[model samples]
Every structure is written in C-alpha cells, then in structure tokens.
Target: MKWSMRIVMTLTISLVIAVCLSLLPKMDSSIGINSPYHWPSNRIGQVTDNNLPDLLVQVPLQMRIRKVELSSTRMSLDLSLPKNADSTSVYRDLYTIAQTMLMKTKNVNQVWVRVIDYSGVSDNASTQLVLAMVAERESGKDMDKSASELSLIQLEQELQNRFRITYTSKWQQRYPL
Candidate 1:
C-alpha cells in the first residue's frame, strides 16, 4: 500500500511537469505578445544599429535587415525575407516589425518598412516591391509624453491609430517624414 501511494504521487508530479513543459514554448512571455511573425535573418544584408541615431535596433527573432535610415522624425528600413514567404503572412510580418521599431524608438513619429528582391537590385529603379507599409505615430496633441518603456498593449493601440498607407511601393524611398 505504501509503495502504491508513492507511485501515484510520482506519476502525478511527472504528468504536471510534462504538461508545463509542453506549454512553455507557446507562452506569451517567451516573446512579446503577438510577436511571432518577423522574417528570417539569413537572406541578404546583415543589419546592425551603426547608422541609427537616438535609437537602438533589435531585429525580431527571424528577421534580417538590408538597410536602415533615420531622420529627425522617421525611421526607414529595408528588410529581407525568405523568397517564398507566404503572401498573407508577409503583411503581418511587416506590420509587426514596424510596430516593434516604433516601440523601440518612441521618439520617432513614423516608420517605413519594405521587402525588395535582392537579386533584382542591379536595376535599382525596378526591384520588385514584395510588400511595403508605412506606420505613422498618432499621439494626441494634449497628452503628456515621457520616456517610459512602451508596453506591448500600447504598441498595438498605437498601430490602430496610424494614418492609412496609400503610396508605399516607391522602393527607393527618400525620406523627410
């Protein structure tokens, strides 16, 4: 009887551990909330934060960046993704990356992101624009601003307030946003 009780307790503990282990990767705490869509980093350009000023860049787990530009009020990035990235997920990835950039540098009022086919870059004017978007910050003129760390929920709310991106595919984007 004593051995059977110990066996049952051990089995219960083992089951609990198994269930917890299985859920760890799916937990929201591992990455930011809704943060699963950045592109793969092994494609074309390996990006670093050398050129960006007043901002620090963190490429989300799988994404690679080709070029980045920062101006007085805007941040622009040319991201490289898998050649076969899914169409539906492409926009989501771009949007999430854009939001991440904005969250990282709360001072910037705009972020422009695009994916261009690296193989076609010899013809700079004609590179295919797979997917592109621009997200502009929308803060109430009346609200007080501070340098506190931005929460993921706040980032989502900020994206919900951006102006519509009407003309994004002009790939050689010159910025003065």
Candidate 2:
C-alpha cells in the first residue's frame, strides 16, 4: 500500500510539472504582441490593409513609413525622414528594415527601401530622394558558393554583397564596404 501511494504521488508531481511547463510560453512577456516574434505568418504574401502596419512596426524604423507595397516576391517601403537626420544612421537603417521584412515574409525574396526628405520653404516645398537600398535573399545557386573564397572578406562585405545602395549617387559614394 505504501509503494502504491508513492507511485501515485510521483505521477501526480510529474503531471503537475508538465502542465506548468506547457503554460510557460503563454505566461512569458517576451513574446508579447508588441514584439516582432510573429514571423513567417501563414498569410505572408496575402498582406492586407489590417496587417501592413503590424508588419512594418516590427522594425525600429529611423523615419516614418509613408507607404508599403507588397507583391508575390517583393516588398517596397517608402519612408519620410527629417531633413536634418543623420545620413549615416539612415543608411544603416535601410539594411536593418530590409532584413527584418525579408525574415518575416517567407515568400518575399527581395526588399526595396526608399527614404525621402523634405526641404525648401512652404512655397517651394520639395521632396528629395536622399537614400535607398535594395536587398535580395540568397539564391539557390549562391547557397552552395562559399564565402571562404575571399581571404579578406568580412561581415560587412558579405552583407554588402547581399544588399546594395540604390537611387542616390551621393549615398552610394559615402557609404561603403
């Protein structure tokens, strides 16, 4: 009878532990809705008006997102930045935003980010395309290609090869490998 009681107690303790472990994920705040954990959604390419903002807010954009256009294999983000914003940071923000979007959308292989700034007085208010970047995920063929081929290759070089500055000559010159 004592052995039987011990067995029942052990089983009950094991069951209680299993139930608590199962609830751990739900109790954790790390995966809250405000976070960017909702990746590779089943409805990726089928983006609608309701989900676009949620998708974009995943990244800490340096500027305000003006518009976003999604296609079967591509995502395009048009953003507006303050005229006095730092050029170097904005340049880096381009890559950061693209990477997050690409990772979040399984079907999206390419991401294009455009950042525009406003200038001139009210009468002559003008918008200037200050910076832009285009990034493409690794191709099937490139997957087999080794980065070891280049002796001096670095992470920045590898990232540069994957993503590139576009639309603005001045930014392309200022930003480098």
Candidate 1 lDDT tens digits, 48-108: 3442421224443244677878777777878665555543344445556554554444456
Predicted model with the maximum lDDT: 2
lDDT of each: 0.52, 0.62
In Å, residue 8's CA in model 1 sits off its true spot by: 71
Residue 87 in candidate 1, Cα distance off native in Å: 2.4
lDDT of 2 by residue, 115-141 (tens): 776545354256667677778766211
Residue clash pairs of candidate 1: 39-62
Off by over 4 Å in 2: 1-49, 121-125, 139-159, 167-177
Tell me the alpha-carbon RMSD of every candidate. Answer: 13.6, 9.9
lDDT for 48 in candidate 1 is 31
